[model samples]
Target: MTYCKVCSLGSDHPGIVVDEQRVCNVCRLDMVGDLLVNYRYTQEVFERFQHAGRNELGPYDCLFMYSGGKDSTYMLDKFTTEYGKRVLAWTFDVPFESTHAAENIRLAKERIPATFVVDADDDNIKKMMREVFNRPAPRKPGKYLDEKLPCVSCRTFFVIRAILHAHRNRIPYIALCADPQQILTMESNVREIVRGFYTTFGVGLTDELFRGEIEGLLFAEDDELPEIVFPFIAMRHTYDPDAIVAELKAKGLYASSPMETHCTLFPLLNYYSFTHWDCMFYKLNASSHVRAVKRNGGDGARSTFSLKFPGTLDVLEVEGRLKKVTLRIAKGEGTPQEHEAELVAAFRDLGTTETAARFVARSFLDMPAVAADMGIRLS
Candidate 1:
């Protein structure tokens, strides 16, 4: 398959358009004059917000989401040392988080002088995740659902929890460390959206329970809320992931390589998406990494971080083969049962325990129902 020379986005991917110059539509859009102007305006606004909120009476200037990954660690250092902000660093302790990540958190707490808090509501979080996994697939699954539903829902939960904490403590700002490719702006109707999600998922919430738990957690219609900001996008310099990792290691903030810091469930979820939909959940993010490296005058292919499975398997190589298999299956050259067997093999290769694999596999057993809900054929 052909790929854009600039971003390495494949021509075969849905909604991607490549030009004669071997550049992708995203690159073309990036060249637009107004878009650049708007980006500058966003930076200016963020600066103004930071300056104005510096003298607020709250104990902390910002509530920073700290995952102990390279990106978050870098941002925490900047907030505390560079910007001189009084920060409250909050970590959501997910059950499947890597041991390396936990160690990184311990190191960062020792190195960075910030009020550190780790939220561990395992029972409630597990219950919510069970509902997320078992709920019927969406009628109109938006882009990235097959790969990102669990991550996105979990993020939403934590973001809401962060907002509630910030509001109660009178913190004026909430800072997130998502890279430019993954950043999303807070919408005005976020409250409504959160309520809709809980109702739709029936997330262990009766009417009275929702009123007691959700209503109190959410802000009123006219209540002032903490302003949400993406620090990576607002910063002036390009976000070099490699540089960030190197700096973190040099400062004794983190010890592991980037590939070793993700959630344990990440590989399993990516395997599921690739087998079921012929799409790598991380394909776009990987492409974005390549583009960013090239923009910084680095070799895109050589500098790009490749996803690693538990064993010796390289994820990108697997993606190429999966794409071909998907095409063959579409043209009646492959069998669904063969694909199912391949998925089982892939799970085994990931080194998952038999019981864990079976449990997660059962969660997606209604793929046909999910496909029907989305008005598509799985095979």
Candidate 2:
């Protein structure tokens, strides 16, 4: 049960390799030469694009994705004030968004000078999620599902929708405020990948719906495409969540801490991932937090990073309950139905509808086999 002294990755965690010095492979990689050189290149490219975008004759310099969470709110402010860009702050109003996030959007609208837009295509979004959940499990489900298909697919929806808006409106750049770890390079083949996602996962969608919205847009010429930029990575911003919240509050911009704001389905997703894969989606970010703390000359031991649940769930309490459930299942101390009933109850308590909670609880029928594929034993 040894753990990395730096990132705190336990030896039992899937695929984790800790050396004798009690440091995990991820932490060790950080010590190697020039880890962020690619990010530096991305920053340079972003600056060039920003300059070009400003010089262009367009109504908006960037279509900033404003989730009203701490990071997005801070980045929205920075884009408007620090960068002095003519920003179009766009919020994709997903049905599962936290109530507090909605309030934050209202506050940001009053404080920020950007032109704000909320696109609430609730029906389509719900339809997409239902398709994602109802799709047959892949034959060889791997750790990829641990990332949560619903979350990833929904974000893909956001990206596609943003691209459509920016392209049609002739916005030169589309800005996203994803943290450094989540920042992905918009490579030349991105459109192909995006297209493949639709063809594969979006099979349930009608041809008319696909052709009307995605087909031609995805095939647009590279020159005509809006340049996608990640502001946090471009600026090499050190992401301190606590500082971000404080800064937003100082500006009279109402913002909730990460734990207090997210999609309502996040707790159920976390429970699903943890129960099946023995890991949470935030595991990678937790390690990143430790590295950031040590880089800033602070003790990694003192870092406050931990498994987080979205919305109003008390993280420590949830962790305790999850551990107990894990123990009971591993020891064969509870029947499968009893264990599922308990999880469904927990999800319901966390604000998910009882039907949705039960659906998630039952969704694990095939997960034991998937877990075995990844060399994880599920009891």
Candidate 3:
């Protein structure tokens, strides 16, 4: 089976039957277009979204998932400075987040005067990362062969913690600082399929490695205490990146330069341009992107999936437009020579060339067609 050439919906093979139209069952429902239209709202709808979450008696008006990245900083700035809402900035400081991001969050705390919370246990995060990245395939497993993408796992960990925190604190609003593009790209149906695959991995991996931490999060109480809102969904149409960054910088909200290194594993694996992660991490998370790739309608390329498990990316299956690497080479965006230079530079930062090559190739060449469409822009 193959994807719908027009929309990039994938062929589900034995899992889902595609119709004569070559569109997957999911796409046939037209949910993707519906998702886009419903989420792209007018100013009146935006005001209603904000007003629905208004609470005067709540301890904090909102629990903001603050990545210390630009989007969350912008949201935090507005919540405190303009909107006059008492907000708490929460961070799940994954091990791989740049020190620059750390600096930005630190500065945000001082400038916004918002209470900040961070869950930064390096040892535990590293150990969990080892499970997904270095599973028991010493018989010589491929670089990303745990069959579980690590980047999405990190984001899931953050999300679970935030939900738990909100319930515990009775926060009336839970806000995610994702821009419209990020929110728009998120496919509702694809998430359920991907979650099914990961939940299985979590059960086994957590039993062996985390003992209870992972499962505890999965089973955490889900009492509804707050309404979740994506402020950027409304703001993206008019938000100016430069202006936002400028105001944030002037107010001492971010301490790092915009040009910083980003090799967040999932972004590296999902995008042709690993470097673009710095500019777009908050738009979407790796797990959802991978889910889209495994499902159909992922941009304009045919999506392929793993056979052993239903809804997971099959890394070995790289036929479609994986050759777009050649197109990128023709355009001078990057070449073999430049890749070697990047490898050499990466070695200066204590990473090995083999490790870098494996990841970069996965990021750049494996799913070239989808990568190009998703704004990594190989050509």
Candidate 4:
């Protein structure tokens, strides 16, 4: 006697049903479904420069957000070597970033001496990581769709840093490695981008979380601001993943770490998103079905294989994640929701707050030191 919640039907829908829930087939459209139906951008409009020569190149024109990951490396190749832009590649190193991430940066440097700007405070990162895990909260809806869910924080930091760096360094534009699908989800317009700066981290999030680590970073109006570009958006549909990976490797531009592992924080975040399944670390197995589930929610953490990891989930790791969740919930940072008891218990037992607080304080202190090292003036 189940009735559809979306369309209010009884057992007669034409499409494959979901979760045996009474949700109507019409209303069951996930984010990807909506994207395909409503937001698919025309490729031609974005590919205006596809056939152009090196004539468009400008001095100190754009900044590329490089993470030394596969996608980013390919984007760098497309822009600098192919498009012939005077590009400055900027890398922001966050807390809990793996050693492999650092190595990848080194590899990117060998291929192209891009301007690498790293903002890393291990103690601060560890602390925030702890807080993020301790809390019980619902993340932004868009987070689940991102290739790397934990990137919400890291991405915000880089964008803010990039905008500020671009302003101070006189770089006229910022080039994102994000594809069309990603940017569209974040809102493609410049106005949306500015608003996103606030919304993405959850409304009213202060720079003081990291102790005013981002005091001077703010967006300027279009009339007063520099340009920000996304050269990859147009190529999202046309680019072949295999071809790009091969090309980068041939150029000796492969990331220094294992090709499959890019962002280290992914495993932790994925654990919660796919809670029914095993932790992200376990899902990293070559045969693991994480990627498939990510593309389509089928078998989406429903299988027993996904359930096995919780038993082995480390107390500290759970604490760290819960702490982060608590902070986001407390701050009303990204998304909104009710607090969960299990998450609170984990955080309370781990002494993560003390750790995270110390990290925040340290990060605040490190800002001036980093600015001095980079020879950038702080107001």
Candidate 5:
């Protein structure tokens, strides 16, 4: 039930091993080794290599994964306006997006000197998401994450596509706005599992695919594989959502974008630990928002946050509602069928057919037992 003191990763997470001082096993984040390939890469080394490399590689040759949020939005701003990079901003416009998110993407495209692509693979993506959500959760598998998080799956899909895109375009770099918490959250086990996952596709995500391999990218693009660079990592930037918003507005770029909310398969993994069992861990076990804040420049007050359904229109709002229904089911109580219309509406807004939404709602509520029943056999 204890969360990591250094990062948002909960103690119940498969990747963590708590020590005497209550430090979870990923270096207790002493050197940020839990996140970065080499925990030792300083801002100076990052800067020196990037400067020399940029001199040779020139600008305008990187492909960015843009999601019209504070981090990705500001990332686009930096890539086009500051660096003058000819960024091919790729968006995985799945059905779970807010309407305003789509509009934000357009505004970004209109403003930035970059080619914006909307990979509206909603059918396949939703299919994949449905599969993930419908699957049973397992015990915290050591170094093994449940494959039911649609967020992870979708991002993985985009990463593979980005690799292919960069390869086809002969672009030397693949850029993403990975905050510090994301860096830290990429525990060794998760990285190892992901390394194995992408190897099947014949893609190398970075030179040091495993943690502590060494500091290798960003001085220049490595030819053995296209470099995936985290800008904040190179600059050692802290997580500052407020600052990002302020900066974006100063340039008249963004009006507003929905803040992070769990309207997707996030609940399958996050809420699984909570609603199904008597454990203290639940929807906020490994918080993305908290971790993202820590990743940039700010510290997270984990005790201060709770996951909630932002509104009826938030695409993933069904997740929050279904989770409540699931808890009731676990307690053998009747569900709030009166709210079914609103529940279905939440899903339909995200492009899920009403029938599918109803079916999915039932499935989510039914699957927690599967997760709760998982036998813990630690290695």
Candidate 6:
């Protein structure tokens, strides 16, 4: 029962069977080179993509998902100063966002003076996160179980809330402040967008998550909203992340004081994405010169699920989180050494025992290729 990973279709689907196991429809439809070939845009069409997106105005122009990070600050600057569009900045504060991130958001509110909204239910959110991580998932399926893949569940929740917020507010476009390197313009299509959503652990689309019942009950009575647009798809080519930061800083848009991501899990989750996607692929390719530096002896690897680099966190935080749930589930909180032994035993049961033993061989080798293949990377 070999299945094709690409389309998630099986050999039963019409396709040229590859290795007599699985075959992708797209691959069957065309030869390897045919699919891989890139079409050069014409001079006019290429030039068409050069300009900023059309200035579309309605009751409200856009909704900016502001994390008060340097990137989002720059985006807010561009939307207000450069484009002169009235935008709504929406911030989602999950239970786990760091203290610094919260400060950053407050700073943005003071400086920007834009209409801002914050949505969160702290205790419930934390319970959900704990449940998500503590619930045992099989290592074989490889859904979102990369070792120490921090805060994935929370991020997904925030995105869903953001989407619902945008729709209810009647905002036409949603700006993520995501750099060009994080996601590409071609990936803006519906299918790629959905795939990206899944890769980021947004498994339940809103249509299902809400179950056809709007929570607020007010939005259901209001205007009809169908879709939300990612303005980064158009702006990525025009704006630079570093330059955006610099320009905003010049306008007294300093980094926020109570800054944190939308999730408590970012400090750990970002470790993989920042290194692999940003530093290794994007920076090395010269897409952007944001050199990722692991200043505090951190993991310089990337996340396979949502390819991005990691971020700063106290070593105690990382060790504490990893040893808290994974070890506790394995050892029942006996002792530090006992927890380590139990974790090793659990990994062995999952056929990752060798890698766990190697981690014991070297203190910092906690995550190995087996776990890396699950999504984490160590290099």
The lDDT per prediction is: 0.61, 0.63, 0.49, 0.47, 0.50, 0.43
Please identify which of the two predictions, 5 or 6, would achieve the higher lDDT against the true structure: 5
- What would the per-residue lDDT of candidate 3 be over residues 1-379, giving only the tens digit for each residue? 3554323333432223356777555445444665556465333344654665545556687788988777788788888888777788888877566566778877777778788888665665566655544333222222211222455565555565565576667775667765554555332221232354356366665455443433443443443434456776655546555566677778777654333313344333433211211111221222233445545544413211100112333222322223233334435567666544443333222222354434544443333443343333332
Q: In candidate 5, how many Å is residue 273 off?
A: 4.9
Give the runs in model 1 whose Cα sits over 4 Å from its true position: 1-45, 55-57, 136-141, 144-146, 184-213, 216-223, 289-316, 321-379
Q: By the lDDT metric, which is better: model 2 or model 4? A: 2
Candidate 1 structure quality by residue, lDDT tens digits, 2-82:
678876665555445678898887667643464455455456546755686463567898889888788899889988998
Scored by lDDT, the top model is 2
Number of colliding residue pairs in each model: 0, 0, 5, 28, 10, 25
TM-score of every candidate: 0.67, 0.70, 0.55, 0.55, 0.60, 0.49
- Per-residue C-alpha lDDT of model 6 across residues 328-356, encoded as one tens digit per residue: 32223345465566545433332233653
Write the residue-wise lDDT of candidate 4 on 1-379 in tens digits.
Answer: 3434332322322232434666534345543564553234323324433443342334465677787666678787777766767677887776445555566677788777455566555554444444444345443322333323345555654576666676666666666666444554443344444455455444445343445534334445553444456566566456455556567778887743222333444434543333321222222221122332333444333221201122222433553465455344433444322233434344334222443333322332333344343332332
Residues 1-379 of candidate 2: C-alpha lDDT, one tens digit per residue: 6667876665545556678999887677742334355465557657766677362657788889899887888889888888888999998998777777888999999988999998777666666666655444433224323346667777777777787788788886778776665553232133654675666565457333344666666678887777677777753444555577778899888655554566666544554455544555455555565565667666433323212223333433444465565456544576778868876766565445566566545543333433333333333
- Model 5 Cα displacement at 359 (Å)? 23
* Evaluation by lDDT, superior candidate among 1 and 4: 1
Clashing pairs in 2: none
C-alpha lDDT of candidate 3 relative to the true structure:
0.49
Better of 3 and 6 by TM-score: 3
C-alpha displacement of 342 in model 5, angstroms?
15
Over the stretch 1-379, how does candidate 5's per-residue lDDT look in tens digits? 6645544354665555666565565534444542355334333333442553442343446778887766678888877778766777888665555444566677777777788776665554554444444445545543423332444566665565565555555666667665554543332222343454444223333222322221222222346345566676643444555566678778766766333322333334434444323222232223444343555456432211222222222222334565555455545566547435554654455345456556545444544443343321111
Quickly count the clashes in candidate 6.
25
Please state every model's RMSD to the true fold in angstroms. Answer: 8.2, 8.1, 11.8, 12.5, 9.8, 12.4
Candidate 3: clashing pairs of residues = 8-297, 9-296, 9-297, 10-296, 182-283
